[model samples]
Target: MLKTAAAAATGSALSSLGLRAASASTPRRGGTLRIGLGHGNSTDSYDPATFIGGFMQAFSFARYNCLTEIAADGSLAPELAESWEPSSDAKQWVFNLRKSVEFHNGKTMDAQDVIASINHHRGPESTSAMKPVVDQIAEIRSDGPNRVILTLEHGNADFAYTLSDYHMVIAPAHEETIDWQSGVGTGGYVVDSFDPGIRAALSRHENYWKENAAYFDNVEMLTIADANARISALLSGQLDVIDRIPFATASRVKSLANVKLVEVTGSQHYSFAMNTQFAPFDDNDVRLALKYAIDREKLVQNVLSGHGRVANDHPIGPAYRYEATQLEQRVYDPDRARSLLKKAGHDSLTVELSAADAAFSGAVDAATLFREAAASAGITINVKREPNDGYWSDVWMKKPFSAVFWRGRPTEDWMFSTVYIGKSPWNDTFWENESFARVVNEARTELDEGRRRSLYAEAQALVRDEGGAIIPMFANYLSATNLNVEHPERLAASDDLDGMRLAERWWFKS
Candidate 1:
């Protein structure tokens, strides 16, 4: 049956699960919340269409608000939209807006703003990463100044969760377009200054609608791309918290008197994405050869410091509802890799693998470890260490094979649609299977839970055997914060720093 929009998470329920470590003191307001992030590019922009990496995701949540939110306990919560109801078919949805919500510039928000903001990601000329998501909408119209309606091409039980994506931030309407360049929105903080990929400063919104939130008076976000520098900034008292803590040094940081380690296991995973359109990778045998060549257990132990688990050559992980736990775990087999490489018309293969630590905490080291393991299978991997400054823009999808990481989506359909679909902009591997694509679309609208599970399991099998992505390990979100900082009992596992809403969701103890 189709899932209802009912929220299953509550304060008492989260406390019972012990999701968050409780603090002795209550949350107090009025202090600067400083943060250092490991992911940021010099090419980062204010356009929501281009927001990628950890730094930009966190920045979006601070200065912009989406229509819906995935709460700390993994439940849907209303943001700008107060309430919503579907038209029984789950295709047409009507969202009632919150009354008198003001933008950062003091303009009252209405249905027109929501409509224009959503439509910006649509249309044929768009290059937004979320175009595939919004393209599912058949039509979007306003019922009145306070209500907006969206009619999807197919019935989707997880449509509300899609809008909670960081790319769907609402902005004031300007004719047919939104003023995304100004960084203006109806969020808890107002953008004071922004230098692309360098630093950003924001002040608390004076007339913020959520009176109980946004405890910080100011937020200073730094793009500390180096992992060591990011940790140093937090430990030296130059920053309050940091994301992407190096797992190799986590224990040492935890031993510090003033620092605390925060780790949450989620759907985040690391992959070696090979462009299927590129040479050698186009063969299915070649892809299978690479998949069997890596030792996932070593990666989990050495690279991750045993903070994660081995992953099949698919994106779905343990955090998702329909995770294929029954699927056989792929193990390292040099003889099988050699047989597959020979079947692909190659006695020995040589490939260049681009990698940088910006992709994850120990990505460069992970690639080196993979190179050592693949050598036994007659695979010579040239690990090219790319620069962190513009790695995502230059090396990620542009290179034939490169290191990558995905903060996996909340739902099965959402994950497959965003990255696995044929026409998706973020389909990093550029691998497409007509049958796999068809199964995913069918699973989206299937109302029967048993039937949907069967379809998703099939989809996982197809990707595991034929996909161009070599997913090896699912890493936990490891971060550190000062003891003076206080947050809710549970942090959002969807992404680091409480789904990148740390500036608003966290506070100072004093």
Candidate 2:
């Protein structure tokens, strides 16, 4: 069910933003729905191999069809490929492609295309998430026109689920060069136009195999960096849907009769990430002191307005199989924090807290909060804010010392492998522990669910004990949409715009 906050502050916030709450009963269709994207990074490549940005996920969901799709309940199900089965050893999986499926470019999807897509991501030039898993592929052979076989070096239980990832979407075999001009894939919609980092216009593919899919004739996604502007656009009817609704405005947006606020508890964990390779943070006591100084509860209640969940050290949520139950009770303790600082030979330590303006829900304010909290623990913090432009590419990823904003994955292995694995390209922290690495490796191959869960719990405990990451809060994704749009309940933490947006099911209420 949808929850609404009835406070006057929410109403005032909406009024200030020039938005009226949309009525719950209103419904309309056939009109082009404009969406305000809160943040937009580079996603110029149509090739799945090079696509990694959030904007790419939105675009891929609409235009590319993966072999499998994650269902509403987070279970893997067949999509472009009808069904698949793994060999007893789990080293090989065979997929039977759906014959009825065809690309928006009017070409029938074949086993060759699937094999080509997989190979493309496996090539030396690729930067796909499937790089790690695909590197183990010993061979990829097509059985016939519809069946494809994937032989890996070793067993991978999560192999099936990885096929459903947005990055693995199959593309035509003949696409020799990256072409954004003619972004083609076997999906429900065709790209009308793509203006990198600005807007992408998509038109429904009438030949879509899915019945009664993509209700909107056209979808105009506009990247709007300002929260106030996004709210204004939604209220003024310029946008039918909006993403990354400001927490300060969530209450106000919920009260508007003509607007519906959808909140999804996200896998994103906001943290003051320290480059463990450098400085005072390199010391365990210093890291522990910083973690104990900040109050996560206060951040959630006051800053986030109870929209998000409190996080301990691990980014993976409680629902994940490997979450450590014992660490759930870790809380703020300033006295302990001060003592830790003294133990680290720093009665008063000075450090720079770097954060990008574009990071976090209330990033600037969040940094301010951290500064204040550090002060209480007798630690000196110098807050540094960077511009949103090129922050991810030029600053966030390459920074030797900076705050980190990570959107977590559903599985513990995926989270650890991508971000914390010592040699991982995505390991921004540059912090590596041999014991943590060993646990991650064991968890990856552990076929038994219970055993794997235990491994992950131990891995998480190692992170907490060493203070690998300073997580303040688990972020909740909030969005405001016109009540005229139906199926607002489908949104999830994955930021699956096409799947969660439910654009196809929405209709006009006469």
Candidate 3:
């Protein structure tokens, strides 16, 4: 007998949990901050030119300063640069650097430092995630000691916003080495010591330009790979702050008196990506059928404990303007799914579902939920869970079929280029659509907001209709902090950790 829809959706094999609530009191100052980082993926690099993930982002926060910083409201604000103005044609951007700003190594910040940093990312063999943004620049030259000029290939209204990217942070030009251990930046703090993938210690920079910044005298960031271990550390008072708390444990943590949970609706989506160039998923009907078979709401509630939001047909969230609201929501229907599979000449379909143990907050439990849901729809899903070591290189980026965790990007163009674009470095799905490509390229070049929005809307529609990616839910970026520390009222919207956690501003009240 086929499993009933309600029974299939509500199947439970795991215990439930909750998030810790915030205490009612003001913050005090002066204490050594110990933060538990979720995990340190090998993707962590100090080159700024090629860094990815929260580890690098967290490290960069104290190591470098950008010309312009993105405000909490998404506006571009001056950081290292005092101010900036665009030329009449909108092609050239002239920035006035802050003269009093000095690097941690006692070197004064100048336009030459900005030029060198930008050029380093633009050069070959660079690993900077901001490379794409700098690729549009025709030239970056120092106009004077305190002035820098940027000539873009075309007029881009978002050029200033691009400068606000964490990876675009300026570095010292005279540094003999790129070790990053020397702590030669103009940021709020300076790196005291760094033991890769283990621990990183930082101290407040005495010469920080921003007033009352770097409130904590010392910060020790520990890389804790296991969710339970991190949670234990937080609850036991071993950690002052912890990030990426598991959904299952959120409620339990919230119940505690000392912990304060901060839930920011992330731009990220956790989904199973099928290779369109490969066998079974090559057919659109098979892909759609698979998507229809999985009970996503159940996974969100049961596995993720309803801490996440459901993705509207596409991965891009409501925070972006181009999301398609008209597309039909992909609900689970085992009957329809089975019918499609049988029509495609497979009465019983078997597929491999690969996942990484430490990829998501509750990934192991989430995969089991998927297994049960697929089984109810007459599909045999063989689960393969890999360890944290080399999982990205061996299972995710290299494998043809896999379940991957993706942190949501800020812009629609960034999401398209990174994941769906043909031959992209991180394009694991390997979907190649000529029309989709055309739409994205056009959207990138279109300066008019209305025209670009329309183009992106069309592209999102195409991805939902033709793409093989099954976006289950939009995961929430969870951070738990001690009530004794003063955090920013608003956090960065992007899941990228660099700007999201204002560690520099956090002060421990006594």
Number of the top TM-score candidate: 1
RMSD of each: 2.1, 7.0, 8.4
Give the distance in Å from residue 123's predicted Cα in candidate 2 to where it truly belongs.
3.6
Worst-scoring 10-residue span by lDDT in model 2: 1-10
Q: What's the CA error at residue 510 for candidate 1, in Å?
A: 2.5
- Best prediction by lDDT: 1
TM-score, every prediction = 0.96, 0.89, 0.87
Q: 188-273, model 2: which lDDT tens digit per residue? A: 67888888788888988889888755667787778788889989999998898887787888999999998878766546678777
lDDT of 3 by residue, 218-256 (tens): 888888988788888988889888888878888987888
Q: What lDDT would each prediction earn against the true structure?
A: 0.87, 0.71, 0.71
Candidate 1 per-residue C-alpha lDDT over 1-510 given as tens digits, one digit per residue, 9 for 90 to 100: 222423452222332322477553567779999999876777888889888778888889988888899888777788999878877767988999998999999899999999999999999998888999899999999999999999999987778888988899999999779988888988889989988778999999989999878889999999887878888888789999998888899888889899989988888999999999988999999999999999999999999999889999999887776778899999999899999999999999999999998778788999999999999999999999998777888898999999999999878888988888988999999988999989998888776768988999999999999998999999988999999888887888777888889998899886
| lDDT against true structure, model 3 | 0.71
The best-first sequence of candidates by lDDT reads: 1, 3, 2
Please list the residue runs of candidate 1 whose C-alpha ends up more than 4 Å from where it truly belongs after superposition: 1-19
**lDDT-superior candidate, 1 or 3:** 1
